[model samples]
Target chain A: MESVRKKRRKARVDETLCVACGCCVKVCPLGAIAVVNGLYARVDTARCVGCGKCAKECPASVIEVQEVEV
Target chain B: MKKTNQKHWYDYLWIASLLYLILGFFNILFAWLGILCFFIPLIISIVRGNKAYCNRYCGRGQLFSLIGGRFGLSRKRDVPRWMKSKAFRYGFLIFFFAMFFQMLWVTGLVFAGAADLRQVVTLLWTFKLPWHWAYHGTLIAPWMAQFAFGFYSVMLTSTVLGLITMILFKPRSWCVYCPMGTMTQLICKARHAGEKNSDKSDFVTEK
Candidate 1:
């Protein structure tokens, strides 16, 4: 029997580069991103479908979509 | 996770907001510069199809973040539900535009010699506070000065309101219902809809 693994695309934020401007928060259809503590943008990976809207909308260009094994 | 506390050039824009207020305080003419604040966001939204100006370049927002977040002035409470509601946000945007149009109308009247220049700043759209001291007669037309005063009043009033909200709630709470933010959001939505329609048309043509 061979073990099978599943992979999915998810959006991730570079905490260092994020400006916490809330642009991602507005553009996210799933409402998975938020400006935390008025400091940086935090993306909730579970709800994020890797749509790339937030990545495109981010002014700082800190967000990226990556394939992850689930 | 290590968070980098790096500062970007745009982060320093709060100084511009402070300088604007200071310059306006010394000379009412400087208030005319507020036009940049009025047009820049809309232009960015139309040209770039995003809210980059509100997110990255808003000096007033940076100022509030500095005061309310860095200085610990904000209670950090979430803004009231009503304030976050679409009805309230749109209502505020409409009310803001009404006030803006009224100011422009007054400026037009002054330009046409239909009304005298009023050297007073109306605070919160109600109380008219005398701002004559800031106005020193210059070589420019009185109507120009009139527009400056009116525009400055709008800018100053909004700034005061933002500071109040910043202190009482989250640092960037004012951004939630900011007229410029609302306008840019609408523009972005319109652009998004237009793009979607075009995509649909392309798909249909291909089929």
Candidate 2:
């Protein structure tokens, strides 16, 4: 038997660059992102499918999607 | 590649917010224009089934971003956890509506000849400040003027609150708990849910 490897995509936010504008929160289709304490946008890896909607809508361009091994 | 700093036509809406404040300063009656800010977001949310107005067209948010981000007025700190909580946001919305209804009640009293119009703008829902200088006895009814005064007070108070929070936290932090933003978000979610249900029904019919 062989073990299987799975890769998934998730959105990441750069807290240093985020302006906490809530644009990503409004555009997130899965409601996977929220502005945490009005500080930065935090993405829930479980809910985010790396759809890139938040990254596209972010005014600060601080969000990026990357593939991760699961 | 999308340029993060690129300016769009909607980016200039900050000017409109400034112009509105200035106009209301000289003549409080001009505050009626605030209704556009109140209704346009709801209308766009209902019609487009999105938060496009809040995302792209909110003048107040733009103004906050300009002053706090561009001008470096904000401390760029994190807002308190309580301010960002759902309980606080919904409570603030309910309180805001209660104050709005009280404003309408006062206006109704004036309209029904049960009370006299007071040329005062209450700040922070207390501390009545005389606003007689702004009025020149226009042809508009007294009740209308009363409503304008009350409405302008609400708008000004909210702006002041936004400015204070902007100075204390990150730019556009006010959007996190803005009553209008909350309302529009709810409307957008409701619309999306309805669309999903309709799509499921269509799929079943096809099957």
Candidate 3:
């Protein structure tokens, strides 16, 4: 039987408060975070390593990281 | 307009770094100093802000822009889609760390008398680079040489990665996948969080 991988944490952006300053986009190592349409930050869960860089760098404190089952 | 064209302090640091890289070939200690460029900037970014090191002192990135722009090597081509993918960058980071830890582990083995230093040095071709001459055939312990080898490996790897991407895509394209840049960004974020928390406490006290 194949072993199951543990759930991984991913960063999520609350679009409502995001100023879209692109700070998170500038800092994400994997390019997992991007500013869409110059409006708000978005995280591509598939690309996010749950490293928490985006959440920490978000000046608005609008990003959060949570564990999810894949 | 002349003031705007004035050379920044970081421009000098970049030139110093280039000189250090050449001098490091004679003394591994100089090489170690050269490599400190990464750590020093990372520390500044954490304590000051993300832009501290990146905007002010990253000589390599500046050089990339300078040369890439002049020679038209800095193409506007979109970075290869795969290069931007998480799998590639994360995999590279993981692989880099694995090699790093492996070198450290071997250093431990040498200390334990379980491994020959020369044999260990031969494990990676990178270990024998001529730039490591300062540590060779001297009183310096084999492990020191090994440590320097490992450190230089990481530095050279990052430099090459940046160079390739700078030539193939935009001058700053390597920033997209740089592990050190990511680490500094993480540090910068933590600093911001702390500042925010303090501001919140101050607000509570004032009210």
Candidate 4:
């Protein structure tokens, strides 16, 4: 028996779950996460460092991070 | 702690675009290399569509788009407002007209064999033109004024042209209008059409 799941986009930050905090923005080493729309900042997944600052500083703890599979 | 920094192979393309532009086009210094940049990617794009150099590569395009995306100038699948942006519309008008006149003048000179280094320098210079007197004569006109204006025109042209072509038609205008894309598709077509003809005989024999 096997299960199939749709592959989600890697390292995407959900805008809805975002609490408009700058922690992830600050913590990113790559300068990837930018506060767009003035409130809910956006993270460019392609540029994410995956250091987990976003996951940690996210007061809502909603910054979901992913790694590229080798 | 052992340091681990991971990066992608494609990053090289960005650097390549920069070096190519710097050593090639900026001076018109390397005629051969500039020819490679102008013609090769154009050939590639025509054959492959957006992937050749426009979408995935082409350092200039990548950088321009990155800057625009940074500033929220990127367009998505959604229909973007047309001419509704007076700034954009007028900006593009000014840009295209300027480019057109400049190119026309250059072409005329080239035909007349009067083109010189002075002309090239003037064309590339920020303060050398008439508009500079009006707009860039302010307190902030000296240093990055050129860069800002260049970016402004480049981004606006690329975006507006893309918007007009893409939103107005399907599969976008890269198929036809883009010089680089058009040239590439021409090459690809010539090659693929030959392959298709070859494949037809094989198919009939198999059947």
User: Tens digit of lDDT per residue, candidate 3, span B30-130?
Assistant: 54665577678666665555444554466666666566655667654546656655566567667766877886797688767787654222223253444
Chain B TM-scores across candidates = 0.90, 0.90, 0.74, 0.39
Give fnat (model 3).
Answer: 0.00
**For each prediction, how big is the interface RMSD?**
13.1, 11.6, 13.5, 21.1
Candidate 1 segments whose C-alpha is farther than 4 A from its true place:
A1-70, B1-4, B194-207
Note the Cα lDDT for every prediction shown.
0.75, 0.76, 0.59, 0.40
Candidate 4's docking class is incorrect
- Predicted structure 1: lDDT: 0.75
Residue B65, model 2, lDDT: 77
lDDT of 4: 0.40
Residue-level lDDT tens digits of model 2 in B73-124: 9887767767766688789999999999999999999999999989998888
Model 3, docking class: incorrect
Fnat scores for every prediction:
0.04, 0.03, 0.00, 0.00
Q: Order of candidates by TM-score, top first? A: 2, 1, 3, 4
Off by over 4 Å in 3: A1-70, B1-4, B85-91, B118-136, B193-207
Better of 2 and 3 by TM-score: 2
- Each candidate's DockQ score against the native complex? 0.10, 0.13, 0.03, 0.03
Pairs that collide in candidate 2 are none
Show where candidate 2 strays beyond 4 Å.
A1-70, B1-5, B194-207
| Best of the candidates, TM-score | 2
Winner on lDDT between 2 and 4 is: 2
